[model samples]
Target: MKKLSNTVLATACCYSSLVAAQTTNLNEILVTASRTAQSVDETLASVTLITRKDIERSQAITVADILQKTPGVMITNRGGIGKSSSIFLRGTSSKNSLIVIDGIRVGSATLGQVSVEELNLSQIERIEIVRGPRSSLYGSDAAGGVIQIFTRRGAGRLTPSFTISAGSDGTSLAEVGLQGGDQNRWFNVTASGITTDGFDAKTTGNIDDDGYHNQGLHLRLGQRFDGGHELEGFFSITDSESEYDDFSSDRSDTLTKVMGASGTFAVSDMWLVNVSAGRSWNKTKAFSGSAFKSRHETVRDSFTIQNDLLISDDNQLIFGLDYINDQIDTNNAYVVTDRNNWAGFAQYQLTLGKSDLQFSARVDDNEQFGSYTTGGIAWGIPLNNNLKLVTSYGTAFKAPSFNDLYYPSDAYGGGNADLVPEESDTFELSLRGKYQDVNWQASLYQTTFKDMIAWAPSPTVLYPYRWLPSNINSARIRGLELSADYQWQQWLLSGNLSFLDPEVRSGANKGNRLARRADRILNLNLDRNFGALTLGATLHAEGRRYTSDSNTSSLEGFGTVDLRATYQLAPAWQVRAKLSNLLDKQYQTISGYNQAGSTALFTLAYQPQ
Candidate 1:
C-alpha cells in the first residue's frame, strides 16, 4: 500500500458481501455537492457515499461509526456511546464542519457544534460527504465541509423490518419499522430503543461503570401531484440520557428534534423551482448526583427558495436565497441570545469539448456582523483517456457562536463581543482514474485561516489568572489524501490514508500543531462471500496528537482491528455477530478519556424479501 502514493489517504472496504455494487461506481448520483443532482464522475468535488446496505451489514450503532472510515474524515469521541463526539475534516476545527439531516441544518447554537454521538444509524438510508469548503453553497460552518444525511423513504410494496441485538456490558438494541408506497404516494415510520451499561469513561476518575440510553422515532411522507410536482414532509426526534464519570456521577439528558417540508415544481421544460422550510431544536439538562445543574436549549429556523435552469445540453445555472434565525434559552442569563442571517448564492456550470468548469459565489448579511462574500471556481482537465485532473480555489468564513460573544461573565473566562468572523482560502488539486478492476484517487490541498479565535490568559486585579476568547491566531494546513477500491469475483478490498500538517502561523505558538487533530490516519477493509455466510475485517490506526494549543500534553497513537460475520437463516431472516477491538488495545483520542475495549455483539434481524 505504501507504493500506492504518499498523499493517497483512504481505504473504504464497504461494498463486498453487504451488496453486489462496487464502491467505484461512477454513475452514482449526488445532491450535496451543488445542491442539485449530478453524477459522481461528472462532479468536480471530493465525495463519498454510504448506502443503507452498508450500514446494516457493518452493524454500526451510531452515525459516527460509519463516517469515521471514509476518506479525509476524522472523529474524536470522549468516551463510549452517547458521549461527546467531534469531527475534523482535513485538519479543520469541529465548528468548521456542518451536519445536515433531510436538508435541515442541525446543531447547537451555543456550543457551535453538533452532538453527532446521539444520532442513530437505524433511521438513516444514505449519507453524502463532500470534502472542502462549501460556504459558497451553504452559508457558515461549511468552511470545512458538509455531511448530508437522508432518512429512510418508502418505495415499493408495503414492508416491515424488525431487529434486536444484545452485547457485552449489558448492551441491547431493538427497532421496528414499516414502509409502504405506490405510484403517487409513499410513507415510512420507525421506532427504536438502545441502552448500554458502558465501561468507565476516565482512567483517573471515579471507578464506576457509565451508562447510556436512547429512544427515537422517525417519519417521512411524500406525494406526487399533477404536472410533475411533488410535496414531501419529514419528522424525527430523539431523547437520550448519558452518564459519565465527572462531577460526582454527572449525567445529561438531551432531546433533539427536526422537522421540515418541501415543494418542488416543474415550471417548464428548461426551468424548475423548489421551496423549503425547516426547524431544529437542541435541548439539554445536566445533573450532578441527583441535583440539577443547568439547562440550555437551542433553536434554529431556515427557509430557502431555489431555481434551476438548463440553458443548453452543456450549460446549467442555479440560484437560491436563504434566510436563517437562531435563538438560545439557557438557565444562565446573557445579554444577547438571538441573531438572523440572510444570504443569496448562484452557481454556473459549463462544458466545452473535454473540459469542465464551475463558478459559484454567495453574499450573506448577518445581523451580528455586517456582510461577507465568498466565491469558488473549479475546473476539470482531461489528461488522457484513463485519467483526469481537477483544480479548485475557494474562500469561506465562519461567524462567531453565542458562547464566543455573550456567555455572561464568569470567574474563569468571559466572552468577547468585539471579535470578528474567521476567514479562510483554500487551493486543491487532484488526479482520478480507473484501471482494470481498481479505481483510485490522489490529491493535495492547502488552506490558510485568518483572524482565528483562541482562548488566552487575561489577568485581572481581582482574578489573578483568567482566560478570554479573542481573535488572535492564524493557521496554515497542508494535507494529502489517497483512496482506492478494488473488486475481484466475490471479494472486495478498499482502503484510505490521510497525512496532514496543521500549524499556527502567526501566534505565540507559531510552529505548534493544532489540538486534537492526528497528523496521520489509515484504514483498510477486506471482505469475502462464501456460500450462505459472509466475513469481513477492518484495520484502523492513527498518529499521536496534542491536547492543548501549547502542545504540553499529547495522546499516543494506537491501532485496533474489528471482525464481523453474517449468516443467512432463510430468505428473510439473518444472524450477525461482531467483535470490535479484537486485540483489546488501550488507547485514547482525548487525554484521560478511556476508549472501549474488546467487545462482542450478536444480532437477529428479519425483513420481507
Candidate 2:
C-alpha cells in the first residue's frame, strides 16, 4: 500500500475516477434544506448528509463527532467527550442555528442551544445539515442554518441488532434494537447505555478525574390507511450525569426528552394536508459534592399545520402555520418565566426550462417583540449537462433568551427588557457539478448583522461599570467553502476546505475576529474495501483561533489522524476496531481545556441479513 499527500490524493483520485458510474449510486434525498423532499444535487443551499452506514463505519459515539468532519462547520468543546460543546456554522454564532428531531424543535430556550453532545448516534438513522440562513422557513434561531435528525424507523422484514464495545478510559457501550414493518404498519425500538471515566478536563488545574454516563431509549411507530392517510409518532429520552472541575468537584445531571405525532391526509388530487404537534424538555441540576447548588429547566411545545397544493406539472405551493410556547423553570427567582410565538409562512416552487426558482415569506408574532417579517428567494440554473449555478438571498433574526431579558437586578448586572431582536441579511452563490464519478460543490457567501446582542459595560454608569446585555454591536461575515468526493472501483476519497473572515464591524472590538472561530479548516477521508475487509483513514486540520474579542489569548492550529477497520466475520456478524488521535496530538479547541489522547475501541455487532 502507498500513502499520498492530501492535495495529491484528492486531485489524482478525482481525475482517475471520472471514467464511469458505479453500480451503486448514493443520491441522497433531503428535507431540512427546504421544508420539502428534494435530491441533494437539486437543493440550492449547502448541505451535508450523514447516513446510517456512514455512522456505523466511522464508529462515532456522539453527534458532535460526526459534525466535526463536515465542511463549513466548527465545534468548541470545553473538555473531552460528554462536555459542553458549541457549534459554529458558516461564521455564525453558536445560538444562531436551529436543531430539530423528527420535525420538532429540541433545545434549551434559556440558553438558545441544544445538547448535541448528549445525542446518541445509535438511535439516529440520518442527519441533514443545511448551511446558511433559513429563517424564512423556520422563523427564529436559524440565522446560521438548521440541523435535523431522523430517528431510525422500521423497514423491510423483522430484524434484530445488537452491539457491544469497550475501550480506553474505562469506557464501555452497549446497544440493542428491533425493527419490523409491513406495508400498512411499522415499529422500531432501541435502547443504549454508555459510560466512561474520562480524562481531566483542565490541563493545568485540579487533578480530579471527570467522568460521564448516559442511558437512552427510543421508540417509533407508524400506520398507513387505504385513503392516502398516514400517521406516525416517536418518543426519545436520555438521562446523563457528568463530573467536571470548576470551583470544586462539581457534577451535573441532565435529562432530555422529545416526543411528537404527525398525520398526513390527501384532501384532494391536488391538495395534501399535514399536521404535527410535539414537545421537548431540557432539565439540568448541578451539585457540589453532597450539596445541591442550582437547577434549571426549559420546556417547549409546538404545533404546525401545512398544506401542499399542485397548480400544474411544473408549479407547486406550500403554506403553513406554526405555534410555539417556551417556558422556563428554575430554583432562582426571575421576572418572566414564559413566552409564546406564532407564525404563518408560504412558499412557491417553480421549474421553467433549465431553471428552478423558489420564493418564500414568513410573518411571526411574538408576545414580547411584536410582529416581524422575513423573506427569501433562490434560483438554480443549469449551465450545461454536468454543471449548475445557484444563488440565494435571505433575511433572518434571533430573539433574546429568557435570561437575557429577566435576570435579577440587585447586585449583579441586570437584564435589559427593551433589547430588540438581532437581525441579518445574507447572500450566497454556489456552483455544483458531477463529472463521471466525481461530485463537487463550491460556494461563496456574505452576511451583515444589525442590532447584535452582547454583554458589555453600561455606558451610563460612571465609576463602577455594570456589565449588561445590550444591542451594542454589528458584524460582517464572509466565507468560501469547497467539497469534493470521488468513488472508484474499491476506493473512495473525499475532502473539504473552508476559509472564513468573521469580524466585529461596528464596535470597540472592531477589526477583531470572533471568538473560537478558525480562519481555515480542512478535512479529508479515504476508504478502501478488499473482499470482506474495509479500511479507512481521516485527517483534520484547523487554523489558529482567538479566545476573546481582544485577541489576547489564542489557540494554535493542529492536525490529527484517525484509523478504522471492519471485517465481516459471517453473513450475520461483523467485527470493527477504531483508533482515534493516532498521532496523540496535544491541542485545545478552547483555552485551558484538554482534549482526548490516543484511544481505541473494538466492537462486535450482530444483525440478520
TM-score each candidate: 0.94, 0.93
What lDDT is reached at residue 90 by model 2?
90
Q: Give the TM-score of candidate 2.
A: 0.93
Across residues 178-283, which tens digit of lDDT does each residue of candidate 1 receive? 9998767888899999999998988876898889999999999888777667788999999999988763338999999999998777787667787889999999
Largest TM-score belongs to which candidate? 1
| Candidate 2 residue-pair clash tally | 0
lDDT tens digits, residues 1-609, model 2? 011112222222221111112222334556677676555666778898887788888888788888989989999897887898888999887778898998999899877778778887888987889999989999988999999888987766999999999999988999999999876788889999999999999876678778999999999998877666778899999999998876433789999999999887777666777788999999999998879987889999999998777676567788999999999999878778999999999998788787888899999999889898999999999899889999999999999888777765534466788888999999999998888998889999998899877665454544254557877568888999999998898998989999999888877788888778899999999999997999999999999999876677889999989999999999989999999999999999988889998999999999775
CA lDDT for candidate 1: 0.85
